[model samples]
Target: MNDQNLLERYIHEVGAHLPRRSRPDVQLELRSLLLDELAARGLEADNPADAAGVAELLKEYGHPEELAARYHTEQFLISPLAFPAFRLSYGIAAAVVTVVFLVGLGLRLNQGGLDLTELAGFLGSYIETMLLNFGVVAFVFYLLEGLGWIKPAKTGAGWDPHKLPAVKDPDRINRTELLVGIFFTIAALLVFNFVPHWIGIVSWHDDGIGVVPILSDQFLTYVPWLSALWVSEVALKALVYRAGRWTRRLRLAEFALSLASIYVLYTIVQNAVIAKLAIVDGIAKFALWILLGIALLESGWQLYRLLSGKANHPLGVPSIRENQ
Candidate 1:
């Protein structure tokens, strides 16, 4: 990643931990400060670094949680000196709400089977009560602190930067995209293999709803191989989602999948009869060719990225160095 990308990621992580109303302002200021810091140290923001390369600076700056806390405490409703007590009080009250909710649920279950409507109402109330409890407790503390009636006994003197976490990468895959891919992939696998006829147009008859089989017998021959590839693709996507970043191995795996996809698409367009109907076959072949082109482009880019290591940081959490 470039110095600028790293700077943005660090700021983004900090902003994610910040309250919604303060996020944009905090991120903007944080970005400016980080850029200034990098420039002061003679670092070039436009140039690509072998790593985030600013791990040391980030560590010394503060952990995401601590930095967010520092800003959060300074908000209008809360001050740093009163924050510890406010947090403790809120925690205790929240626990009481949970206990009350659980007790009510137990009583209802013991009396009779809880219907869905009653269960939903109970859940709604539980959520509302918890939020109400939090607001009440926080407001009381806020007032007490404002009136100088409550304060922390001592200020924190030994916060550790070593306990900090990490940030994002430009190459970071979208988890929602992966989840959607998995869903479509699995659905296709089921439809193609177990219910091939479902792919065609649906018709409503006097007897019942009917579906005409659109896939040719040749598709049956390729089902096992295609299903295997689809399954592999889903598995890899799931792994990337779990890791929250792409690693070298995952990139290679995806590249390999792209190659396999290109092969399957090429073969289908050239040799396989995807649809028994003439017009459908023509349309399917055209679509397959388009997919093949996309696969080739994606594979080439993946190989280039692997070789160049242009973005030095692989996906997942970009690790920051601990204070020495």
Candidate 2:
């Protein structure tokens, strides 16, 4: 067959399995590569007898397997980190995009200025972005699977079923740990809300749930809910730190609860009290940011110790580097 014919079949075979959005580009590139390889082998499209030799050359290049592997390696699941992170980030992005699209549609329907044509145009753009994102993510996972880096184990004699210990505990939150977590969490809340209000950064709420302090400015809200969120997060972190093992289900429950609390608080404050809070504007904000930074560092250090099998001691247990 001619170079064009050879390239057509080759590109079709490979691109058929790839993401549709990227199929055209990948097809073009693969065709070019095949032509170059054929040319390098001294094969000519003009000579009719050179057809079989060209076919043989294409066959030797391996039945689109190597090309598929290359596509996977170069474009998708490049590493272990990339694999799981891609899944998470893609899921989050998809959710955000879906919400934005729905909101835009609702707004357009409510507003009289937006005609059907304009609505269709806006929707077309949204659909395009959604499709492109989905294709890219799918291709990434496909590539990762194609490569051996993320391949499933063959389950042979070398595997020891009993030696692999479980990292999770069914009873994750014990009474003692839970009590201690509540204590520290309550203390932190008192420091942030009550103490700050006493010093004039905010005001203590006397009307409703008086345990949490409310912001002084009517235009600045979301403080109470945010304080509650931070408190819960601190409690969860404490539980995890003290126990060191929790069921996946429990961890997920905690995450959902914390996020829901933040979202609800944000919504209520934005609608009822103030649209936004200027957490970036004051000494209190700066101090809170500093505390957050220190907490992150401490958490990271603790995680490192756990991973390095040195988590026998509690958090803040210094290493040799600290002494140095």
Candidate 3:
């Protein structure tokens, strides 16, 4: 290729990856730089370009992706200011998607019995859901950043160094645990309400396919209360995230939720037959009993901690005296 053609090709490749707003200026600057570099190397642009020389010059300039990367001053979707929020949102989304997909797969296998066609359809739908959600989250954050709605915590006129609190024990309000709770609660609510069909089993016989629901029809009756409980937990977690510390009120709220959840579990487990799998009916009942036992133990633990004051440090904000 001639020198002009080679340079234009290189410029086009680089420009392809650049943002449309800055592409024209970037291309012009890149072209000028390439021409200047060639002149410095004593390669005449006027002559038919040697393939070897063009290759060497492009190599020195770096790969198109690397060159384009240097020009990216702004983040593609999420700015640094909104990164923590974006991470939390994406994490919750990912967790919900995974749980829904797994639940759907399990139900399909248990109810209809598995076929390759069904499995492929489920996988394709899962991938599409994940990609769509990821794009939506990223675009929302990008729009927020573009509109100057989410500024860095330390920036802007309202921020004050003097108002910053002293560092307390890092154990207070475990962010990771809170995030996990929020994710699972949201996932459970989604599966229970919007996608109840995903909680069943599929079986295959010589003649046809059969579907058996894992949850009893009565399970639907508890969904509204269960959903409310989950929504409250999410709200509490959001408050903790905003405050960056756990308060006494939050601890009390959590304790109340735990108690309510234990009660709900008790009522649900009393039915003895939540799932109707022919082979695993006994095992499923055993699992529900085990879950009830765990909830009881958790409630006892919470009560003991509340009374003994052990839960104060982990779930309560440190006092000013404690910080000293």
lDDT of each: 0.69, 0.52, 0.66
Identify the candidate with maximal lDDT.
1
Q: Pick the candidate with the highest TM-score.
A: 1
Residue-wise lDDT of candidate 2 within 1-324, one digit each (tens)?
322344455555455445545545566666567678778878764465676776666566555434454565345333332444466768887868866765555444333336688868987998899889988876866676567455423222333222322232233346676667677777767765656543223435666434333344542345576676767677676656666555444455464654466355435432443312344223333333334434443455545544543333111123445334
- lDDT, model 1, position 257: 87
Model 2 regions lying over 4 Å from their true place = 1-134, 140-154, 163-171, 174-180, 198-215, 219-264, 271-324
lDDT of 1 by residue, 1-324 (tens): 342454555676566556655665667677668778888887755556613446566766766556666786544576544555567788788767766666566455534438999989998998898889888987887788768886333224343323333454556778888899999999999988898878886799999999888889986788888998999998999898988878888888888988888887666666777888988876666556545645665688788877765344432223333111
- In terms of lDDT, the poorest run of 10 residues in model 1 is 315-324
Count of backbone clashes, every candidate in sequence: 2, 0, 9
Question: What would the C-alpha RMSD of candidate 1 be, to one decimal place?
Answer: 17.2
Which window of 10 residues has the lowest lDDT sum in candidate 3? 158-167
The TM-scores, one per candidate, come to 0.48, 0.31, 0.40
Candidate 1, backbone clash total: 2
Write the number of the candidate with greater lDDT, choosing between 1 and 3.
1
Q: Tell me the deviation in Å of residue 164 in model 1.
A: 25
Q: Which scores greater on TM-score, model 1 or model 3?
A: 1
Better of 2 and 3 by lDDT: 3
Give the least accurate 10-residue stretch of model 2, judged by summed lDDT: 160-169
